[model samples]
Structures are given as structure tokens and as C-alpha cells.
Target: MKTIQRIKNVILLLAIITLTISCNSDDNGGTIIDPEPTTISKYVVGFQAFPVGQASPAEYILDLPSLESLTTGEISVEGQGIPLRGWRFFHSAGNTVFTAGYSDDDKCIAYQLDENGALTEKANFAFQSTLDNYAALDDDTLLAVELTYGGLSDKRFHFINAKTGLLEKIVEHPIDIDMGSGTVEDPGSIPWVTGMILRDNKLFVSYHKWLADGSYITPDVDRAYVAIFQYPEMELEKIIEDDRTSPIGVNGHSTGIEKTENGDIYSFSTSALSAGFTAASKPSGILRINNGATEFDTNYFFNVEEATNGGKLFWMDYVGNGKAIARIIVDDNIGAWGVFKEQGEFFKLVVIDLINKEIKDVSGIPIHANRYTSPMFVEDGKVYLSARTGPAIGNNGENADLGETHVYIVDTETATATKGAKVLGLALKGVFKISN
Candidate 1:
């Protein structure tokens, strides 16, 4: 009887151990066992290598503890960071980091933090054309616009599933091109998208008219145009125009239209030659479209050039509380393409109050120049921007003498800039925080 009782006890103990192991481990080979929840936070920084000897620049993504601190004198991707092929554009939504290849590749890859706190590829998808404008409708949906240039055709809008990295749907619409004076034989102007925003089931796209023949000439430079479309359906409702300012937004940089907290939409017009415009027909300014309205507000007009006494707006991002941080061009001699080619210190950081129409210059940051800068990151009323000083290009077609790149932390309320970590790359494409 004692031997039988001992055998039963041993069998019960073995069964308990087996049950514990089965609960903790994946029973099926295809099942993925999730790691324990972690409270640690990680930041992902995208860096672009200098295209000196290579045919195209390579992008690297590195996970860091903080963007403001660096253990070394300057952080580089020499033997670290996940290297990506070709020139890429980086954007983050929720916990995923997205890198869209440009010029060299037509793929967009989405990365997420794994159980080991490393950036692991989650999804890879391809697109026909480069995504020029993007907006996050929600955490799961990303709307990207592709402008079909070279001829009159239908512009494509892609609705992508952000989490699954799949193309959900594509909406094509032929946005009416305003060809002033020139006909089909000799096209005068083509619509160049500057910014896109979706608010209250309405989509607003701001664009400028430019010749598609590579001259970069603006045929209709005296009016600001925004095409309003219905959400989900993407049907064009109307094309609103404002004569108070020149074409809204600049080439390459998407800072044209910004929606405030209260739903008021403000469009910035860059009529400056420094912003890649062949001519300046109207003063660089700001126009407003009131909340719940699809037309421009006739009572609202902010003359940025007059307010700053001839300062041309280069790039801007809204912080919070009706305030935005803008990089203003201070030197008039930068020429038409000087912002891209001859970059002798010209950009000045300033805080503009959208509600009161006031401009206050930020202190502690010297004049700097940047080319093809990614969108600024705003968090907790502090705006983080990559500021680069010195020449934009060298005599040998290299990125020589292109001064050090530093992360500038700008305070929205105090209007002050505090320099942060030094980046050892051509420039920082983006800085993002992903929860781990």
C-alpha cells in the first residue's frame, strides 16, 4: 500500500510540471509565444550616409535610449544600426517605423520593436510611384498620395494598412490642372502637391502650379489653391483659391497646410525665390480656412514677409496651442535655388503665434541651413529639429564642409533653443519613439 501511494504522488508531481511547461511554451510550431510585457521605452533614429563614392546613399536605423544624449562625441552607424538600401524617407506612426525608398527603390518597409527591443521588419510592400504626401488617418491606416507627373493623368491615392503593411485600396482622381496661357501642345503648368490634411471627413490638398518640363517655373504664382475632397470616397468637392498669397507650400517640403487643435486650417504660401520658386508674385504669407468651412476665410491673412520684415518662410511645424516653429530665410542673396545649392547660413528659427499673428525669434540657435529636411518632431511643447551649419555641398560634388548636425530642442513657450546630441551622419532623417 505504501509503494502504491508513493507512485501516485510522483505521477501527480510529473503531471503538474508538464502542465506548467505546456502553458509557458508554444505547443504548436507555428504559434508565436509573446514575450512578457516590458515598460522600457526606445527611440529610433534614421540616418542617411553621405553619397560620396556610392551610386546612392544608404539609410540606417538605430535604436537609442534617448535622442538628446550621446555616449560618444557623435553617434554614427559605422558598425551599428540596421542598414537599408538606397535613399529613403522615414516616418513613424504609433509603434511602427516606416522607411519609404526613393530614387533607388520603390519599396516601403515597416519595422517594429521585437521582444529583444530590436527593430525587426514587420512588413514590406511596393508602390508604383513615390509617395509625395502622407497623412495618418488613424493608428492603423496611412493615406499616401502619388502625383503622376509628365502628362495629364489620374493622381493616385493609396490607403495602406499600417499594421499589416498591405495596400488596402487605391483611389484615382484627375485633379484639374490650371494651365494659365499655355495649351496642351505646350503645357504651361502642372499641379505640384505641397501638403495634405484630413479633417472631419474632408480632405484638403494644397498645391502650386509648376511647369512639368523641368524648368520649375510657376505659371500661376499669385494664387493659393487647395482642392477639397470627400473623405473615404475621395471625390473632388471643389477647388478653393485665395488671391491673398502665392501658391501654398514649397517644393519637396510639406508645410503648406496645418490643422489647429480647434479644427481651423491654416495654409502657408511660400512666394520666395529661395523656396524654389522662379518668381515671387505675392508676399509670402498665411491664409486660413475656418473650422467646418471648405472656403478660405476672407477676414484672415497673415503677411509673413511683412511681419518678419522680409523673412521668407522655409519650413514650419505646428507645436501646440496655436503656435508653430518655422525656419525663416534671413539672407535674400541665397538666389532661386540657393536653399538647395548655395547654402551659406540663411535659416533662422522663430516661433509664430497663429492665433495672435505674432512672430518671436528663438534665442541660442545660430543661423543654419538644411536641405530636404524631414518633418520636425514635436513632443510635450518642445520641438526637436536637426540643424546643420556650413556649406551644403563641396567643390567635388561631395558633402564636404557640411558642418556638424545637432538636435535643437526648441521650447514653445520660452522661445529658446537648447542644443542636444551631435549626429555623425549626412543628416538625421527622423527621430521617433517606440514603446517596448
Candidate 2:
């Protein structure tokens, strides 16, 4: 009996040890199990969509691999209301994804993807009355510039610490882009900031001396300038100007300046008349701000229009190894606005060798009328082009419903494009990629 009791005690001790070990393994109120690995998303495509004719475009996201249904319009079909507010293609800097709606109830929103590929909304910033153009400063910060029409006193800069949910506002700065000396803006012209680029703690603001009254005018057509300021402190540094280009970029968009692998910052200015009538003397060209330099390099001007023998620069984004994919206005009659209002008949896609100063029109990419094209993305010496085409309209608008868009994967060496997934209903505004 004593031996049996000793055996029973040993068994009880072993049972308790087993229970404690099991409990330790599942300490966080759940069982521990290995999860199947998820594929890291290769690409995230953003679409600007509308349900019907002339509706304000909404935002949509396409998750790769399981792309059975690619359009966000299908979400509306699933009893989900598509709540879109002037949402532009999202901008990604580091780990966060961000987008904004101009003068809307929700001024901005940002999201973060978890390790398992689940996305969570990190912030939704609502403005009182001012609308802003936001640019990503980093994964944890965003810079919002409130334009003048937001009440003149609305010339405020709001910096949001996206990680900490903290915001700081700066209201005063020395801003005078017009021909005048003081902050008093030129008559019939307002300052339209195209975008902001941050470099080594300095902020470069690209802007146009816009012609108001619903018209376009370049007051001084020969030269364009960008305002440099001390970042975080928000003090004026100096205005850098170059006569090689009309404006530092196209109108109201963020593709103006690109930084290459060599850390050289290149700016493209379109000399199109619709972009405010650039001087005939100055061709649409490329200007460089050498690495770490606050001023333009006077000796480095690659005349893009001259390179194409009369083509005007439209849009440009840098690829690796001193090359860029560019859109040039190949014809003069189609003009700038006609690319939007009439049909996209004037633009041509080409490869630019920044080092060699050569421009070659990309072949195998169809040229059809499109109102807008997606902001191109570069990866591994290739560019992603998204352009939507529709039926041509006559002197009177007719048969306009024949619209379609596709994503093209291009090989820079061959200058040929192969089409990928077709998107329905909306145009692809931008493509943001995620690596596994």
C-alpha cells in the first residue's frame, strides 16, 4: 500500500507538470499554433472611380493574387455604399499609405498594413474649413499646405505626426512668388503649389504663378522658380530659378521632381501653352539640383522638347540608373487642355536616358484618346503604365460609353509593353507596391 501511494503521488506530480507546461505554452488566453504564411503583396493599385456619368470620383484598392473582382464598383453592388471624396491616388512613404480629398468632410486618411497583410486605418483628419494639398514627409509625418482660397488667412501649414496623432500648425511665412516684392500676390494670378519635396531637412515647394479668372498665364514665361525653406522651422531659405523650363512640373500634380539613385534631383517643366504659355525661347526641358545643393545647376539642362525635336514634356518619373519614362506632347494642335477636354490625342510615351540625353518613343504601347493616365511606377528597370481609352467623340459628344483601361508592364530595354489586368468603370490613378 505504501508503494502504491508513492506511485500515485508520482503520477499526480507528472500530471501537474504537464498541465503547467500546457498553460505556459498558451499563456495569452489562447492556444498557440503555427499559421500558414501569407504571400506578401506585390502591388497595390488605386483607382479613382464613379458609379455613373459625372459623379465625383471615389477611391478603390485592389488586393493582388485573389483578384477575382478588381473593381470597387462591385463593392457598391454588395450593398456597400461607396463613400468617395475627391480621393487622389494614395501616396506611400515607408510603411504608411495616405490619401486626401480636397475641401471635403474628411480631409485626409492613412492606413498601415500589419505583418500578416491586414490593413488598419491609422488616422482620419478632418479640417474645420481649410482644404490642403498633403505630401508625405515620412512614414510618421505628413505636410499639409492650405491654399489661399481657404480664406487668405488660411495660408497655414499643418504637420501631423501620424504615429503619435499629434499635429502642429505654422501660420506665417514669407511667400511672394509674383513679380512683386511683398506677400501681396500679383493681380489675376494666385500661387498654385504643385507639390512639396523634402531634402536633408529643407522643404522645396514647387508652385506656379497661376493665372486666375479661369485662364492660364505664365507671367514670366522664360523662367520658373521653387521656394526652399527650412523644414520643421518653416523659415524662407531662397527661391531657385531656371530658364530651361516653364514650370518645375505639370499642373497641380506631384510628378514634377524625381530623385534618382545617384541622389540627383531632376525637375521637368512642360512648355505647353495650356500650362500657362511658356516662352517660345525656352523648350520643355530637364533641370538638375545637384545632390545636397539648394540651387539649380546652371550647366545641366537637357532640353526635352529639343531632344524630341519639338515635343513638349508632359509627365515624368525617374527609373533607376539615370533613366526616366516620360510623356511628351508630340503634337501642338491638341494643346494641353484638349488632352483632357477633347480626348488624349497629343501625348506620347517615351524612355529618356538622363545620362546620355536621349529620348526614344516607346513602341507597342497603343496611342488612344484618354482623359488621364495613371501615375507611372518603376521597379527593377521596368515601368507600369495605366491608360484608359474611350470611343472618340465627334464635334458633338456621342457614343462616350465605350471606355476601358489597362495596366501595362514595360521593359525599358526593349521599350515594349505587355498588358495586364483590365480595370472596369474607373481609371487607375496610381499604383503603390508592397514587398513580401
Candidate 3:
């Protein structure tokens, strides 16, 4: 049986696949379908596999589509049965792996991997006895922001020595504001640290500034900048402020900030604020700001109206020649395009024309009606999407709960979507390009 992680949250992640193909479709109006090309290269998918109810943690490095075979390793280094909640593969000068997770005890733990891709007991850290948000600054340095409890605030950021597992530098600022009379405090509102990215020698962090009354405040348009710093020293250099859009409020959270080759930065968040509301109550949107600007581009907001809650952009990338293709996984929207309400409730992989800012709807492609899927584009113009054979529910519901998901690869050059492979008990997560 396939091992699955029991995430207490509303949703849990599983697997991802990608292939190579064309960019156009045929007269029949579907992704071009050709035989699974032989030009494919094997990309490694490192995942955490655990059963639904058990705490026995095992790590997996699997070649997707071949569910039967797996290179199994145990995450039993420092502590036995550490629950892996999240994983990210970073860019390195040499080969290195940095993974962060919560322990079975609910404390934060960051683990390192050896050159051979095995989890190492060499570098490890227990984060302040709280659930902390962390990202790799690089191979040697790491950024860790603490999660607050009982309406209390913590540090804004910390720089840790990835090699020595020691705190190098720290940034902590306290904010005091009333939580309106009669409102209780929620510790979950702790500035949920989203993602961290590096450009030039500067570090950019996407974080929500938490408010005192148990709620959070989106950064002011002037303050809605990537919290900037320099490397190694982790000094507060300055903020990459933008003047592109007016001051709009976010729910004070965003996924990882994405950067293009042209040095443009992009970020998305699920918020509950109106464009005209105060900094604490505006709706959520995907915001884009060019480099060095202090304003949120009013034009860059993709409003998921009325729903203050939704899954985040788990992955984003530039596809197509000359950066024409853009794919983003909005785990809450479930692959629907346009300003539709139902679109924001499920997981979705949106294919957008970045230059034109147009996302292709299911009607524009060959996907079944309401058959939501997350897609990844690999080399040679290939796009891959995965869907469960039955209903659109993501959890393990009745009706083929195990191994019902299907993967389809679309060759945009040929404009065809074809069923490429099947996996038992697998749900598609994010995709990474392994080759040029």
C-alpha cells in the first residue's frame, strides 16, 4: 500500500509528474497526443510517506508514475517518527538538501541531506519550542521565523547556520494594537511566514505583519515590500518597496515570492479584505510588483472574491518560449479560470499567457467539466496535469479512495492532452523542472 501523510489541515499533498512534448493542438481541439516520447529524463521526487493514522515516518525518493518501486529511507535520525509536513528542494552551488518539518511533538525541526540525498543527523535545530516557518537562504545559511502562541508575537526573522545549526542573526519587532473589544486571540494568526527568495546579494522575505488583537495586518502599499536583507550577515539592508499600485491590504500572508529572469517578483496570498477597506480587512489577491517598487500594482490583483480562505500557490514557473507560458497551482481554486466563486474552493493548475495575463479555462482546453487538476510543464514544451478519476474532492473520500488519480500530459506544440500514466493512491503536488 502507498504511504500517505495525515495532515490535520484541510488538505494534504502527495505526488507530481512531468514530460516533454509540443505547444499546439490538432483540429480536434485537445492537447496534442503522441506516444510517450523516449527523450524523457528521470527526475527525482523526494517525498515523505507515512500512513494515515500512524506516526511511523519514512522518507521516499520515488520516480513518479512507477508507484510500485521506491527508494525508501527513514526520517529516524535525531528522533524516531518525525512528521514531515513540508519539503522544498533548494538551488545550491553544490548538491545539498534542506528540509523542514514538525516533530511528532509539534515542534519545528529542520534537517539536512548528504550529497547522496540521505537525511543527516549532522545539522539539526529545534525551533524555540513553537511551530516555526523556515526557508533556506542558501546552502550555508537559513531563515527561520517563529510562530506565536496565545496572541503573543515573536521574531520577524532569524538567520541560522545551516552547517552548524546555530542562530547567526535575528530580527524581532513587536507591534501593539487592540483586537477590538470582545474579540478573542488566536495563536494561529502568528505571522505565518510564507516564503523566502534571494536576488543578487539581497534576501527577500514574504511575511504577514501580525496585529495585536489576534488578527493580522497586510503591509502598507509602501510597506508591502519583500523584507530585504543581505547574505551571510543577514543584516536588514532595506525593503524592496514598489510604487506600482496603491496601498492595498493583504491578510498578511503569502506563499513564496517568485522571480523571473528579467528580475520581476511575484507573490500571491489568500486574504479577506476589500480594496477600500482598512489595512486589516481587505480581500485576498495575487499581487505583483516589479523590482524596487513600493506600490502594489492595482492591475496585478486576481481577486477570489468573498472567500477569505483558500489554498496557496504551491508552485509557480515560467513556461513557453520567450517566457510566454505561466503555470500556477492555486490549491483552493481547483483549476478554474476567470472571476468565478466556485473556482476558489478547490485545487487548480492555471495556465496563463504571462505576456497577455490571460489564463486558459477548462473550456479552452480538453479537460473534463469540473475535472480540476494541478499541471507542471517540463522540457520540450510538455505540460502534465493530474486528476482523480471520480469526483473533484481532494481528501480520501469513498469511491476509489486509494489510487484513483490520473495524470495527463499536454504537448502545447501539438495541442493534445493524453492520459500518460496512473498511480495508486497518489495526489499531485508541485512540479520541478530537472532539465533545460
Model 3, range 1-436, lDDT digits (tens) per residue?
Answer: 1333355222422221111112234345547556863433233333333234422324433323222122122111123323344322222111222333433433233344444434444444555544344445556766666556335555457666756555656677432222334345332333345556677776666655444453334334333445666754567666544433222222211234656566666664433122112332333334665566533456665543322322223234445542322222343322323211111223344444444444443223322211211224354566654444343333333332322444456555443455554433233332332211
Candidates sorted on TM-score, descending: 1, 2, 3
Q: Estimate, for each residue in 1-436, the C-alpha lDDT of model 1 and write its tens digit.
A: 9999999999999999998777767566335667878766687878876655635557898888675553235768888899998877787667777888776779888888877787788888889888777766678887777754555556788887877767778998867664445565577556778888889999999987767654667778889999999987899999999998898887666668899899999988867787788888788888999999999999999999999533678877777799988888877566776776423477888999988999999997888877666667777767777777775565565556556677788898999988877777667778778774
Q: TM-score for all predictions?
A: 0.86, 0.78, 0.54
lDDT of residue 55 for candidate 1: 53
Evaluated at residue 95, the lDDT of candidate 2 is 55
Rank list by lDDT: 1, 2, 3
Best by TM-score: 1
- Mind giving the per-residue lDDT tens digits that candidate 2 earns over 1-436? 9999999999999999998888878758646778887756645555655445554556665444433233222312123313346645455655555565655444566655556776556666765544345566777676766555311231467677756434556455535533333333634455656667788888888776654433455566677778888977778888888876676766535667777776678888877764445344577888888889988988898987666533777777777778788777656564445555323445667888887888887876666443444446666666776666554445444544565666666777876777666765445666666533
Better of 1 and 3 by lDDT: 1
- Model-by-model lDDT, in order? 0.78, 0.63, 0.40
Off by over 4 Å in 2: 1-42, 66-83, 86-89, 103-106, 114-116, 128-134, 149-155, 162-172, 177-189, 211-216, 275-281, 341-343, 369-375, 391-397, 434-436
Which clashing pairs does model 2 show?
none
Error of 1 at 300 (Å): 1.0
